[model samples]
Target chain A: MLRLFKNKFFLLLLITVFIFILMGVTAKQNSKLNWFSNTINVIFSPVEKFFSGIGDKIGSGLSYFGDVKEVKKENAKLKSDIDKLEKDTADLERYKQENDRLREALNLKNQFNQYDSIGGNVIAKDPGNWFDIFTVDAGTKDGVGNNYPVIAGSGLVGRVLNAGFISSKIMTIIDVDSTVSGMLTKTGDQVIIKGDLSLKEQGLCRMDYIPTDEDISVGDSVVTSGIGGYYPKGIFIGKIKEIRQTNNEFTRYAIIEPVVDFKRLEEVFILKNKNVGNTGTDGAGK
Target chain B: MKARNIVFAVSIFIIVVLQTTVLHYIKIFGITPNIMVVVVIGIALLFGNTQGAIAGFILGFCQDITFGKMLGFYALAGLYLGLVVGIVNKRLYRENILVIIFFTFISTIVYELSVYLVHEWGMHLFSPENSNNLDILYAVRNITLPEAIYNSIISVPIYALMIRINDRFENANKSIRKY
Candidate 1:
């Protein structure tokens, strides 16, 4: 035992194991915890700015020609009202969809005005493959709390995992630990959605305990059932990505593609309401 | 020694910020090379296990802190990688650039694999429903291995610089002894 101390290899391993054990024990409690994660975000802000500059340069270069072409194209298209009307119809259709989504979201938002909502940009991604989470610019000072739902234009992102003064970390919908109660929007069949962080960029979530007899087609949409205290009902979750139905299995499962585009995720709204019920209007409405 | 140590710490801090926010742009096939991991391995080879482990722990800790992960995951992974590399280095001649390159190549894989395993197992325990559906091999190929390889290549120049620093320190010590 004395000689083992001399081996730095063994010593390092021992220390790591001890730390792991200690972390496991206190994982539940909110100790001093680590502020270094938040500190790193602040330190890395300049780096993000540098990249954003490069992105702007590249974007401007590519769009310069398109900008010139677009002016002429806009004039030509404006000359023909019939063609212009068709284009306007398509645009109007898209706008209607957008309007409806926002309308639903606004209705949901009105239910929880008691709690403040913080708007923040996603500053960084989950560092490595070990976790499927994200770091955002909102924190405790922003009124964001643990398990606060984050939403984009589409629907759900995840919930607040760790929050600071100016920023908070979100465990994305792709993370394995996240479980959102959702239902088939067309059929009203309740199911539990789990995140596949492994396939995060694909925006995949898994649905379990789905009845075999249910009419769950490939394109059937999923939405939060509001059974879970965190996410309010009627928020669009995703379309069914894939289905794996085994003969022996009693309950079928399907992979869902989240409505939010994870790759282009930037600014998101951090919802402060954990209790979706106590809020004024029922989210599931006519 | 103190000045050199401080330089290592400062350089690593700068590199990590660049690695996460800047180098993320250099992604090829969904894996952005991990510059910090390679740097840790390079430093470990030059300074031996104690310094190597220290560097690894700090760098990995920095990654975890910045990325908002479960604390100490990267730190422990890095510490072990550095120790293993440092210990094996005693029996091998790492003076050649090819040797350093090879070291980086192998160590990166080791580092990534360790992290991935911990992640899967941890997720399995924390959320079993999410764990059963993952394509582990695809995840590694798309996101893990390529980044490791890219970082390994990047570490070649960095390891050469580390060797140069070591040489300068040894030369200074020799001059002092002669005086």
Candidate 2:
């Protein structure tokens, strides 16, 4: 046994077996890190955050120089747009009060809007191109937890995969492993949006299970149906980009152009359900 | 020797931090060069199999913990890569830039393909969706080839730096031995 241990090839084989075993054990979704990994994360989070801040500053600084003329033109355009939006907001506020009164009369719950959200910065991304997982600066300390729905400014990003002490891993919607229950905003048809390995390079997702007879067209919006307990209802996913016919004529899949610019993603918001206790199958069914 | 080990360990940590944070901004075609693979190759070429393997394992483990869905996949890839490169260390001209670049390009392809295979196998075992040969062909053309090219280009400066550091450590060790 001592001589076998001394043999380099034998030692290599042992380590290989050990690692394979470790992979098997931790292959499941939402696997908690051991003490060693947790400790490393605890130490690495702040450092990663600091470096990410510097990188962000450098990136913006470089872009600022290159796009100064364009920025000024865009700024003037945005000012007019803001003025128009302010007038629209005033009209919407009056409508909102009337809607609130009607909702109170009907005793209907505001299913999507009743959640607390914590903001986080993207500190680190997965080192390889194979996965779209990233580390965010929010953790359980900030009331962020596993399976919390994360979103960017434009639309749905993904959900928290694992929450550490001061950092959480987010699996974005473009990752091959990600799947969300979504619906067409125009026709109210339920569809499954999943990440495909080939499409991930283009920062797009695959929307599958569309009924043949559904009048779904390119540019129709898709949102969470709230059927999956993970995401709340009515969160904007993306617009259909292209429709493709499957081998089975009854079903088709469409490519989705996600509204979030995932490559340039810097910040995100993780939504925490206020009524956490009642987030059961009953609510999912509705 | 101890100082060399410390420097290697610290450099690995720094590489991980830089790869995750700073490297994301510098992506070409939505893919960052795998700097860890370059560094592992550098170590294996400079120090032989044992050190190379150890470096690969450590780097792989760090990546697996931080970003991987499975704990040992990267670790396994890194370990084998380091071992294989280290085995060839004895016969190669370590100072030749082209040789290093060629090694890095090939190693990255092997590393990424192994990762793809393991992931596909896992998907086959656990998930309902089975990836077909088209997906494999697409991955090789789009992902593996571009990544390998990127890694090879970036390997030049990184390998040079590793050579300098290794030379400095060896000279210091020689002086100590003489004393």
Fraction of native Cα contacts reproduced by each candidate: 0.29, 0.77
Task: Please give, as one word, the docking class of candidate 1.
Answer: acceptable
lDDT of 2 by residue, B1-179 (tens): 78987997889889999998999788888778999999988889888877888899999988987887778888888888998998977647988988998999999998898888878777777765634223778788889999999999999999989888988988998998997
TM-score of 1: 0.81
On the 0 to 100 scale, the lDDT of residue A185 in model 2 is 71
lDDT of 1 by residue, A73-176 (tens): 87877789788799999999999888668657544443544555678886666545445676676777666666667888858888777665666768777776
User: Each model's TM-score?
Assistant: 0.81, 0.89
Residue pairs in steric clash, candidate 1? A37-B65, A137-A167, A138-A167, A138-A168, A139-A167, A140-A164
lDDT of 1 at B100: 83
DockQ of 2: 0.71
TM-score of chain B of 1: 0.88
Best by TM-score: 2
C-alpha positional error of residue A138 in candidate 2 after TM-score superposition, expressed in Å: 0.7
lDDT, candidate 1, equals: 0.71
Candidate 2 segments exceeding 4 Å error: A1-6, A29-33, A67-109, A247-251, A277-286, B129-134
* Model 2: per-residue Cα lDDT at residue A34: 49
